[model samples]
Every structure is written in structure tokens, then in C-alpha cells.
Target chain A: MSDRDLIIDRYKDLLKTYLKGKSETALYKGQQFSRKLIEQQISPDDVLSDHVSVLHELFPDMSEELKDSFDFLLEVMIGYGFAYREHQSLRTRQRQLESEIEVAASMQQTLLMSDVPTVDGLDIGVKSVPAKKMNGDYFNFVKDHKSVSIAVADIIGKGIPAALCMSMIKYAMDSLPEQRMQPNLLLENLNRVVEQNVHPNMFITMLYGLYDTDLHEFYYAGAGHEPGFFYRASEDRFEDMFAKGLVLGVSRQTRYKEYQLRVNLGDMIILLSDGVTECRTSKGFIERDEIVDLIRAHMHKPAQEVVESVFNELERLQEFELRDDFTLIILKRKV
Target chain B: MNIQSCVEVCNEWDIVSARQLGRNMAKELGFGNVDQARITTAISELARNIYLYAGNGKICIEAAEKMGKRGLKIIATDNGPGIKDIRKVMEDGYTTSGGLGAGLPGVKRLMDEFMIDSVVGSGTEIIATKWLR
Candidate 1:
């Protein structure tokens, strides 16, 4: 025999030794089985006949029933191999999807204002949670010694585009000098910029406000934003500051409306995107009043706590994840 | 049935509701998932612009069959004030309010078709479409 044939014979002798007196025919059949046969490397018809004849030599009394058993084992092994290949493919696909989601989440995070600007006598806190890997809502605080600007805008849609738009809005706000303090003038300029550059159909609902810590006053402009809530600790009640304005990016000529409020000690200002009010409950949708009550319940808490409490309540009421991005900014004045 | 729907209002809370309703309508009409997301986002951006810059305006979401496929058309109209310069507004990184200035341009990218009509004093109307083929 050639050296290669000698190696095959030695491999068969080892198999026979391992199966001594324990079904020699089964061992011989298993040892001679070739996975390559099923893969069409060898003829399927000749594979079984040749392997069986080799096994019959090892066990002269071995029955045909034993040969059938060997065939079944080979079939099972092929099925297992196919299943393993499919499982490996699924695992690879899952890993790829996870990586994509991670990257998207990172991109979305970049759209948020990284740090809150510092202003005297003011405590501000902001929080945002996306329903998916990306968010459509954004908030930012821009400040100088004279005044602090707080902005909250919700892009009309979700995902990477919204995230990119959020970044654009942030960069625009960062480039604006303090001289552009007037909310209306600022929004007007922003409108022209967005209308000219943004997709013809995209727009933004924003509430931009400049708070003068020295004067204890807030100058605000609203463009398609929701009615903000102000809590008067002295009165122990909340009032809606429903300023009106147009959405951003519709027309270059559109004018924004401006409003003002005097900040007092122990007063709290709450700004939120539609996701807060539009959160759906098991029975139905969450009413605006319920959100107000939630704010009231956590009125005495810190600004951060107030924001977290509201989100917690929303989560408790809903069985499923929030359908939209949820964001909130709380501004509180200390005595 | 052939129908056209349009709304002109400030980009405010109510208008957002309008956009959401419009999105639902588009979905009911069997718009593709990707197309529906694009139209909804585009409409929201336009409505928001009307509220933010124009102070008040309106938006219209219309549906029609085009090329044997369902198509959604969105038009946002505002008379608040017209853009000073359309070219400047269309340019990226040029914002008056320190915002991203990405709203309009971003919407344009999301849609399959886009068009804009505006006058400095009159107002602006944007038309965009997503076809479910």
C-alpha cells in the first residue's frame, strides 16, 4: 500500500480497537463514512455500498439492519451541519445590527448640547430619551454674564436626519453672537437660514428664550413650540405660557413672536417637546392635565428630579416604549 | 377619489398634531414605511418653520395616484413674512438664530421629490412628495 493508504488503514485499525466487541460493524461503517460524499465530493450511490462492504469484512455476521442505522446517523450529521451554518449566519447578522445601532446612538448623542452654560442664581437641568436609537428632540443652554439663552426644539421627524438637523441647529446657535439676543430677530434670521438650506418640507418647532439673571426676567420667542409651564411656588399653582410663533424653515420672510416673563424666587419654568404630552397610556393617551399633576407632585424636588419624575410617570403609565422622543428642560430660581 | 388637503398655520403644538394626523393618513393610504417617515418628517419641519419664523401659517398634505403608485404631496404655506434671500436660506451653516439651519435642507434630502416657492413679503409654500412604488 502507498503511504497515504497506510495512513487510512491505520486510522481504520484504531477505530476497530476502539470498538472491540462493541459492534465492530458499526465502528467500521462510522470510520469509513465520508462527509465529502454528501457534499458531492464522491458519488452518493457508491459511498454507501463501499462503506457497507468494508464493515461486512469486520463483522461477517453483521445484519443489514445495522447498515440502515449507519445511514440514519450520516443523515442526522448533515442536518446538524446545515443548522450550525445557519445559526452562525444569524449570529453574524445580529452582531452587525447591534453595531449599526450603537453608531446611530452615538451620532444622536452628538446632536445634544454637550454642557449646560453657567449662569448666576439659576439652576437649569435638561434630559432627553429617544424611543429608538436616535432622537428628534433637542435642548441647549447658551450663556454669558449678561444673560443665559435656553432653547428647546423638536425636529418634525426621527432618526439620522433629525439628529443631523439637531446638530445644525446647535452649531447655528453657537455661532450667533450675544448681540443677536432678540428672540424674534434671532428666529427670523434662523428662519431665513433654514428655509433656504433645509429640505423644502422639513421644519422645526422651537422655544428660544434669553433669561436675564440680573433683571430676573426672561425674553422668549416661540416658533411652533408647545405651551410652556411656569410654577409659582408662592401661589402653589402652575400657569401655561402659551406664546405663539411660526415653525422654522417654512419661509425666509416668516416673523417670530416674542414674549416676556419676570422670574421670581422659588419659581420653576418647564419646557417640553410633544413627546411628553402625546405619550400613550394603556387605556388611552395621556392627558395634558396628568402631566401637569405629575409636575406638581414633584414640584419640591430639584430641577433634575422634576424632569426624571415626569419621565418615570410616563413610563409607568405606558405599557410599550414611547412612540416619540421625550425631552424636558427645567429652570428653577433660588432665593 | 382625487383629493387635496392643505393647512396654513403657525408651527405650534396644534400644527404638530396636524402633521401627526397627516402621517396617519399617509400610512392609511398605504405609503411605504420609508416614504411615510420622510413625508412626516418633512411636513413637521415645514410646519415648524411657519410657526417659528412666520409666527403663524398653514400646511397642506395631499394624496394622489401618480404613475400607478400611491403618492403623498405636502405643501406648507405661510403669509407671515417672506424670506429675505432664498439662496442664503438654502445654504448650510448660515443661520440667523444660531440654530443648525438644517431644517429645510434636511427635509429636502429625505424626500424623493422637492420644490419651494416663496416671496419676501407674501409668504412661502413648499411642495414635497414621496411615492410608494
Candidate 2:
């Protein structure tokens, strides 16, 4: 006999023994048989169908109503069987996707690794956190003689695609030497690269800024990115630093406008992604003024501590669960 | 060709049921494999939005006839917190739930006709259609 037939025979014997007497020995044998059935990948509907067939042979005088009830149960089990299979397959796919993403995320971290350069007269702080394993936000700093350049970018997509695009951007930016010092030219060149290489459906928003230590001037440009804040320490007030330009990858001919700000002693310039300003809370999205207030509350701390404090506060407001990638950078003039 | 199927989307199983029903309807309407996949993907996204954001909702797939063309229409309705900013949500790379950020805009790209109406604190309703070519 085939394995299925043997199983059916054993199942019939077990059912007959159990029906004769509701004994503990028969229940134990039935449990053992069930394990075998499970090992054979037999579904519940198949087991019910086998039970009905055995019952028909054992009790030849069974009523049609009783047989019909068994058929009804078998039909219900068939639906249950399909749903169970769908659930199992979906779970398997989810696990596989999650592990693959985890591997990609770690590889991204290794590919885009960079150190925060130490520059005199500038207290710089930066942080980037992803809500998921993969991050769509990117930030990099390049140190030049008597100056430091910062680039904060947000990709319009997520997953492996976003990570690959970011790595490409990292390598592309690393190849340029003089362009890094000029915010507008840097963005224009990067925009052309993205437009030519990346997919049309994807776009990138970037904020590039260069701080000249000797001249105490901060030059910045934006490509449809979120506007940051310039904290005037002398006036004890914050000012909005807005720059308008098209997002990258839209057009190769797009030109970016550069803006300059005089960084006085103790003044601070904050550059961040929309994840900071658009933080959702129980009430709604936290206002820009609230973020300014948060920075003001931590103004007395060091630049690094200030960024950390702001991140912690915002993270708490969201119940320690970030919905999107969060990136923040602060450049404070200490000397 | 009378097709009017409704699936209550409250959990994961409901999403599966809704998307399967959508694919069946699309196949019944003589849609090709590519269109069938697109319709099912759009239905999955809409149903997931209901499950994730609204907590519970309903998806209705129906055969539509407008003018001289025959199409498949999908309607997803939810009485959740509703959308705070419809314009912002439609923009790419904008996600509040940490997904692929391809929630609504992705669905819009898959369907030929899409319309969404939402009011904060009231509810949201979306209607999308893909005509057989």
C-alpha cells in the first residue's frame, strides 16, 4: 500500500478503537497518528474526509443528515486550508524579505562609512536614524583647508534601490575636489549625475553648505529641500534660512542658487531632513516653532549634546518609534 | 458580465481576500496578466492602507461600463482618523508608517483612473478604475 493508504488504514483502526471506547489508550494512539499525518503535510480537510470514509464503512446504517454534516465540515475545512496556506506563504516571504533587507542595510552602512572631521572654530554635530532597517536619508561631511562642507540628502524611494543610489552619490561626490567647496556648483553637478543615472521615478532633495572658518561665513544651497534655521546668538532669536531650487534628477539643466550667512560668535546653523520638521505626534505634526523651541531649550549645551537632546525629545514625542528616517546636523561657531 | 464583489478588510486575511477578488474580477473582465497583476497590487495597497491606518474598512470591486468602454472599478472606504494633508500624502517618498513610501502614489500609477476624498476626523474614500484595452 502507498503511504496515504497505509495512513488511512491506521487512521481507520484508531477511529474504530476510539469509537468503541473513549479510552485514554485510543486517544494517545490517535495523537501519535496525527503527528505522522502532520509530518506527511496532510491538512485538516483531508483528515476529515478520511474520517468520513472510515465512518461510512464502520457504520453502514449512518443517516444521510450525519453524512451531510461531515461533508459541510469538510467544505469549511477546505476554505480554512487555503487561507492557512496563504498565511504561511506570506509569512515566509515576509521573513525572507526582512533578512535580505537586513543584509543590504548592513552593507550600506559599510559602503557609506565616513568620519566626522575635526575642524577648529566649528563645533559640528550630526545624527541620522532610520525607522526601519534601511535608511533613505544620507549625510556626509568633507573637510577642506580652513573650511568644512556638509551635504544632507533624502531619496524619494526606500529599500535596496535607495541604498544603492546613496552609495553611487557617495562615490560620485568623493571624486570631485573643487566642486565640494562651492554649494551651488556641487548641487548642479550632482543633479546632472542623478538625472543621467538614476531612475526617472526617483528624485533626491539635498542641502549643501560650506562653512569658511577664516571668513566666518556659511554658504548654502538647496535642491527642493527643507529650509533650516540660523540661530542668531547675539539677538537670541532664530531666523529661517530658505533656499529655492528644483529637486535633483528632474532635469539636467537645473541651476541652484547659493545663499550666504555671516556666522558670528556663538551663532548656530541647523540643517535637517523633513523627518525632523514633519515629526508626527499624538496631536498632529509638531510645528517648526516647536523644533526651534526645542533647540532653544538645549542652546546652552555643546553642539553634539544639542543635537542629541533634540533627537531624544522628538523621539520621545513619537513614543520612541520613528515613522521615517530622521537626520539632523548642527554647525555652531564656538570661537 | 455582472460582477459586484465586496470584501471586508479588517485584518491580513481580509487583504488577501480583497486582492484575490480583485484579480478574479479583472481576469473575468478580459484583462491581461500584466493588468491583472497591477489591479491586484493596487487592491493590496488600498486594503493595507485601511488595515494599517484606519484599523478596518471595506473594498468593493465591480464591473463598470462608462460610455462605450468596459472597466473594473475598485472602491475602498474607511472611517478612520482620515488624512491630515491629502496633498502631502500624494507626494512621493512621504510615508508616516515607515513603509516603502509608495502607498498612494504607487497605486495611482497602477490604475488609469483614481480619485480620493478624505476629511479629517470623518473618513476617507478612494475610487480607482482600470479599463480593458
TM-score of chain A of each: 0.72, 0.81
DockQ scores for all predicted structures: 0.01, 0.02
**Candidate maximizing DockQ:** 2
lDDT of 2 by residue, B1-133 (tens): 7657899999999999998899888888898544666688789889999999999989999999999899999999999999999998886556776554247866776688999999999899999999987
Best by lDDT: 2
RMSD of 2: 16.6
What candidate 2 gets wrong by more than 4 Å, as runs, is: A1-42, A46-64, B1-133
- Candidate 2 lDDT tens digits, A158-229: 656777888988988887777988899999999999999999999999999988989999999999998999
Candidate 1: stretches off by over 4 Å: A1-91, A178-180, B1-133
Best by TM-score: 2
Candidate 1 residue lDDT tens string, B3-109? 66656575377576767767787888896433454466567767878888888877777785776877777777788688878777765445564543236655665
Quote the positional error of residue A311 for candidate 2 in Å: 1.8
Determine which window of 10 residues in candidate 1 chain A has minimal summed lDDT: A40-49
Question: What does each candidate score in C-alpha RMSD?
Answer: 24.0, 16.6
- On residues A118-177, what C-alpha lDDT tens digit does candidate 1 reach at each position? 566877777788887778898877777788888888989887788778888877776776
